[model samples]
Target: MAVFTVVNETDLAQWMRHYDLGEVVDFRGISSGIENSNYFLTTTRGAFVLTIFEKLTAEQLPFYLDLMRHLASHSVPVPDPVPRDDGALFGILHGKPATIVTKLDGKAELAPGPEHCGEVGQMLARLHLAGRDFKSHQPNLRSLAWWKETVPRIVPFVDGAQRELIVGELAHQEAFFESADYAALPGGPCHCDLFRDNVLFAPAAPGTNHQVRLGGFFDFYFAGCDKWLFDVAVTANDWCVDLATGRFDGARLTALLRAYQTVRPFTPEENRHWRDMLRAGAYRFWVSRLYDYYLPRAAAMLQPHDPTHFERILRERVMHADASPLCN
Candidate 1:
């Protein structure tokens, strides 16, 4: 949610007329993410998030907006897309597609505990289940094919060891993708980017044992149809990892998977390929981070994440492959 396309208050106040929302009380640019221009907008009605598409085109946007609407309809705690006066989910802002969604209630729990992990796991399982019947289909844009195309471009920026590790892991993932087991994995619309920051947590009510509830999940821009196990892997790689050393936290890992399995039991195939999927998850982020750090686009508040964090994660996943398990 970087500030790529600047939106002035004068322009925003004029644009607010398209929606039923009242006068713009306040709005500020959000500068934490890499994709799209996001603003925290508040009007006479309520709070909402405004996003101006940077890379995603109008043709490629409906899948995300529709998916959010579908999940919200299914009782998933996701942001609901607000329709315009003409019943459109989005409108043109600064010559690019833009939309607003209801802002979730709580804040992101960056320092998550076992209970937090459990909540995330349950919510994610429910999200996957909720999206099963969604009609729109779009492949994960940054999955295997994109990796193959991206690695060659990034190879020029790394050392011999880093290049060799990336190339070898890519070959391994290629083989895994070609396997019959991969084909049988269940598929659906998934919140492919379920990092900790994308989730919000509301503090427990008075006298509730201090158990925070999962407020909602956001950032559906990277979402797409993919194996449900892959989604789980991507989430686990973030929520269950020790951030400093890139190792799995057994308690958090167990809590996450057990909660998830209680909702939707994993198939035998998913369990069997869990470790490989974890490796795939780590590899995906590592490649993307390298690309972003080396070849970046100019945008306000766009701080490219350190590429070494995912490199450490990929190395851990590759070296300690046997340590990762689907559940306790």
Candidate 2:
């Protein structure tokens, strides 16, 4: 979590009063995100996630809240923002946008097995199906034009080999998608960042079907219009495993794709583009990490993550291009 802001009890109480959530009994800052200041608030009412918007503008608050409500209404497992007695989804707290949401129960599935992958795949398919009818029309953040702008900013940060590979990969992806065959691929809203951390899973119970159940989806900051296949590719990159070297895992890929295809079968064109999309997804993260690497970071933070983690994943993806590990 971005630790730049100093949230205090007074700020919490004032924010809660705006929503008429009774007096705040206690609150603790949650340091688990990179873009916002989150606090777990305990009041007479119950526990809730109090988010003070740090990076997003006030104008964008409606879109984020409404999108969460929309997805939740569609049976998507996401944190629905609690409306205040005034019917406001957000309130001002310490000169920053703040909202309270019901805290979802579950832990981050860091090392998801095949069962977890299957559930995630099914949920993504459902998200795509549900999102097709969502009326909102937010601009795509990772569109081709955006990539062109972002790549240049990150080019200087990458090593020689990575820079060369990324440059060639970008051109290849651009040209491949420009073909007529790709013109008709289905387009819809997608959860652009479905990383493992963003997905929460409930634990299995004894004597019951011990399967990884969907918990809640957070971080909609990147949700926007995009290719349905791109979402699939992102999921593959997040869940797939490579067993031989244990460097990459494709088992989750098999489970996820198989489960997803059972619900929404990929067309031949989408099938052909899956590998390319996976490669592109890896590169996308690589670029993002590189950008973060070069950018200035706030000093007050817990366990700063290395941007090169994604870079390593990108290299592994490029090296295994011929393996087509997920095809099995």
Candidate 3:
């Protein structure tokens, strides 16, 4: 529920007519994302997520919509865009690209234990496998070139020590990717951001036995072609924590990796580079935080998140040799 701008009922009504989703029974701003203004729309027909693209341009909408469709068609649990009566996937609302999605059941897991970690891991691996054949022309935002371009933008904002570390890490990441041996691993589309909040878990009935299930794959805005191993590393950072300082979780990492490997076993080379990939994931978020921290925030009407939180995580990752015990 990231409410950046107010949506008038008239504007919403017009948008709904475009999709013919019936009258909006009730609607309110949702605050679960950073890039868009989302609202849970309850209509006479049913419930849906209405997203107003805040940061994405019109040209980028097709990539996201197609990706969602691709995943949904492949049996990956994701919110598929509900097409309009005219078969259009997007409608202009408040002069922004707007679309409606089926509301998925479940809530974000606030405190994920080992079991939850294992479930998430298995689902992520399945998602990776499902996305293996997706054909998209979009550039990978986490690619080596993107990292190199982003480093200079974030360097000045980071502290001196963190800056040096990032510089060194950048070089290491470059070397890791440039090596001919590293070029032979599996590659495909990946969910670049799989933070805890992005995952959803269904409510369980009292005394009923049930396994944790995955829900909506929201925020596919950052998703694109990337290394499969990097996706695992991002999951480790979100699901793993240090119990001593509440930093990174080791047990959760083990469960997650175990479950992920059960679906798609990692190659020997992928296993060898797992630790480095985890380190790179930590630094990726670190740099993103630095960018947000230093850049002037848009004062329009969006929620501002603290970039220091990720910076703290980055510092904690720097202290460990692998950070993820599961890599072994």
For each candidate in the order shown, give its overall lDDT on alpha carbons: 0.90, 0.75, 0.77
**Candidate 3 local accuracy as lDDT?**
0.77
What alpha-carbon RMSD in Å does predicted model 3 have with respect to the real structure? Answer: 2.7
Model 1 RMSD, rounded to 1 decimal: 2.0
Q: For each candidate, what TM-score against the reference?
A: 0.93, 0.88, 0.89
lDDT of 3 by residue, 1-328 (tens): 4777678888776677777677778999986666788999998889888898877778878987888888888888888889999997887777788888888778988788988888788888988899878887576676678778888987876678778888988888889888765787787888888878778888655676656666656677778777888888887877776534427565787899898999999998787777677777887877766665676467522444565656566666656655334532
Q: Assess candidate 3 and give its TM-score to the true structure.
A: 0.89
Better of 1 and 2 by TM-score: 1
Off by over 4 Å in 2: 1-3, 20-26, 205-207, 242-248, 297-312, 315-328
Q: Model 3 segments beyond 4 Å from truth?
A: 205-209, 243-247, 300-328
lDDT comparison, 1 vs 3, better candidate: 1
Instruction: Name the top TM-score candidate.
Output: 1
**After superposition, candidate 1 runs with Cα above 4 Å error:** 207-210, 298-301, 324-328
lDDT of 2 by residue, 21-130 (tens): 67778788887786888887787887788888876778888876887878888988888899987898887776888788877778898878899889888888888888
**Whole-structure CA lDDT of model 2:** 0.75
lDDT of 3 at 25: 85
Clashes of 3: 11
lDDT of 3 at 288: 68
